[model samples]
Target: MDTLVLRLQPGDDLRAALDAVLKTDGIGGAAFVVSGIGSLRGAGIRFAGAETATRIEGDLEILTLAGTLSPDGSHLHLSVSDAAGRVSGGHAAPGCVVRTTAEILVAVLPEWRFSREPDPQTGYAELVPRRRSSQTL
Candidate 1:
């Protein structure tokens, strides 16, 4: 396993930046978001049972972030607190704009490949992890 540490600048979209890491050379196509923290000017979070994300605007502090990342897609969850101390958490979506900085740590798994496939039971695309030989990498 290898690791990547990144500090995202203001105005950067949190989700898009993470997705770009998978396309970088030597990433080996799969990674897990070990941890992340930062401040966001605005965020888009999809709550449980919600079809679309709710736009949250204001000075928000990221409390936690974690998930899997693959070329096929990513599944991340995060919690954030507003200036008023209201906390919200759910599926992390695109359009989460950084305010100050976003510090992230990712674990790259070179021997494994991950993809998303539809699961009949869940009726949603889910992660499918597979092991590949060194030759493939």
Candidate 2:
């Protein structure tokens, strides 16, 4: 396993940057953990069994960001706190703009490859892991 640390500059979209890294670096499998003070000009979050994400507006502090990242895609969740201490958390979608910066930590698994496949039980695509090479652990 290896770790990659990133600091996103102001005005950068958090998810966009992450996706770029996944594509550019060819990260087959990884876990993303992010936390920092920033603003989400507009954030998209999904609650409960909803099929789509709800848009949230305003400057917020990123309390938590955690999820799995793969070359196929990512499933990230984000929690942010507002000025009044109100906290909101859900699926981290695109369009989450950065205020000052976003610090992210990625744990890369070089020996594994991750992909999303359709799951009949849940009706949603889920992560599927496979060995990258035919080597014993």
Clashes of 1: 0
Give the residue spans of candidate 1 off by over 4 A: none
Kindly report which residue pairs in candidate 1 clash with one another: none
Candidate 2 positional error at 62, Å: 0.5
What's the true lDDT of residue 57 in model 2? 86
Q: Give residue 19's lDDT in candidate 2 (0 to 100).
A: 70
lDDT of each candidate versus the true structure: 0.95, 0.77
Model 1 RMSD in Å is 0.8
Clash number by candidate, in order: 0, 0
Q: All candidates' TM-scores? A: 0.97, 0.88
